[model samples]
Target: MASQQTVFMNHGQGETSYARNSSIQNADQERMKPMIEAAIAELCTANNGLSRGNIVIADLGCSSGPNALTLVSFAVEAIHKHYLELQQPPPELCVLLNDLPDNDFNTVVKNLTTLRRSDEPVVVTGVTPGSFYERLFTAESLHLACSSNSLHWLSKAPEDLTRNQIPAYDIDEHARRERLPLVVEAYANQFKKDFTLFLKLRAKESVPGGKIVVSLLGRRSEGISSKFPRLVEILLQILSVTASEGVFEKKKLNSFYVPVYEPSDEELREIIQEEGSFWINEMCVHGLTSGMDSALITPNRLANQMRAVFEPLVAQHLGDVMDEFVRTAEQRWSLEGSLQDEVARLATVAVSLTKA
Candidate 1:
């Protein structure tokens, strides 16, 4: 995994860019729209309208892509609708789209210009470049906060797992899976620390009763059930099988690990409660399909999606071996039969919370 300062989404509109291959994430965000609206409405109604007669909205992990701007649009429309319901004029809007410093802000700004409405004035928008794990805003300076499809990324890969022979993502191998008890525990502990700090920072930045709507990749079962684990398992199996045929070195494969973690619904609830700064308003898990509903699920689309996301992480670790890794994995899938017949599902949890 890359350092915190360098962690970022694949950029530009090329084949591997997050902008081109974020359909699954976009679908998840679409499913989260109602929750976003409801949270905004809840915030507006409770404060005798827009709290300070101005609205400050921030997207904490607003990566460089359509989804980042899409989130901004959702928040803007939701807040606009709230004012309409109150029969009051809308407040001045301050929008903050945040991501790590390495993110392609130029791409984000270009996309924003193409999507802007001519009738509406340019928003007071700021591009915030930093890890969301730290403070970025002044105290009580924000009213609504929104983030989607981002929190699953940890502050850093688990230090314990990186030093070991078994990569953190190899959940399918029985021997490795057995040894993962401690590794899983370490990931969970890191998540707790990161999330606790996230809550603390947000509490300090938001006014009392301010609302935050977050939709992140998570699991429905307390046990590991999400396709993320299985996806990496398939990749690991491919590498192992190909290495036996002298396609690559087994040593190289064992050392690479992607720094990501998915939480179950129960885990998220517990963390929110334990953090003690926010009151949970809504927390639910939704199972999302990665491909078309009527067609059979194939490796082509899934592999492409994985490439868009994991390419950076894999490249950062494996360096020159990244190409071989991708090729062998795709070749293995081609030889095998169907991985999924119809539906390939992933679980995501969306939570709406109020600072208290």
Candidate 2:
């Protein structure tokens, strides 16, 4: 309902910075590699637009940090790899890194110098800053556009949720997920409207036969959220404690809304069909289920991970309680049972589309 409200990952570097806490995104991109490669191969063979001498590919929601350019590198390498398989020279690459205007573009730009590559490919880059739901590029100016782990963030929280018309968070010091039936309907409708508008705008910007690959966190079942432990509920639980301690106003906790919605694969397909701008090439709802097993899971690490994502948004309402909040979160998450369930399952929806 609201338009163009910004949500951002923690921009700079630190334990709580998105750059450090974003390892899971690397896994998401790795799972998406096959879909990306296939799309590039099809773009090379099926579309004659590759002859234009320069290929323009956009990595939407390219948040800053080490993983920022990972997708961009994937597109570039995939195109060149396809050309190499055919023993042909790949065209020049024009890379666009897109994110919210508030995103840490500086970190991404700084990391560009460290990438290993040769000059034969001649990669030129630019930064596109704006909401992807709006027209961020010229008409028919792109060959491929991809987004990862970002679409779940709506253009804004539902106006009803923000205004406390829908009872997502309660007057008491707790999040009301059981009372989320109306909350689910409101969020679903908002995501449908935003995602449909996204398709239409990209259709106007992309070539007639361009490709779009998108992967974001989604529900496995046909519901608003996953059956597994919800990390959001954990965050709300901590926030409510802060409110009860008189750190923030009770009404603030009641009114603050998370501007994100994880749609099911069915809901995604429905929106794509109804929009009618792109043909679904490949679609799936399976991703890393093993979750964060890389290292010993610690409460500090887990809280920092969630804090990197939520600090900016949470700070808007809670003010200077962020450090104290993170401290409190760490204290709560220190128990053995706190995070083993939350980090056990990570599901994502990946779709490859061709402009019709």
Error of 2 at 297 (Å): 4.2
Error of 2 at 279 (Å): 1.8
Best by TM-score: 2
lDDT of 2 by residue, 224-296 (tens): 4433224556678787777778888867766567777777788899999989999999898864333446564
**TM-score per candidate, in order?**
0.87, 0.89
* Residue 206 alpha-carbon offset, candidate 1, angstroms: 1.2
Locate the minimum summed-lDDT window of 10 residues in model 1.
Answer: 336-345
Expressed as tens digits, the lDDT of each residue in 239-348 for candidate 1 is 56656666656666666665566788888899999989999988888765543452433555566666777766665654544456556656655654544431233567
**lDDT values, one for every candidate:** 0.72, 0.78
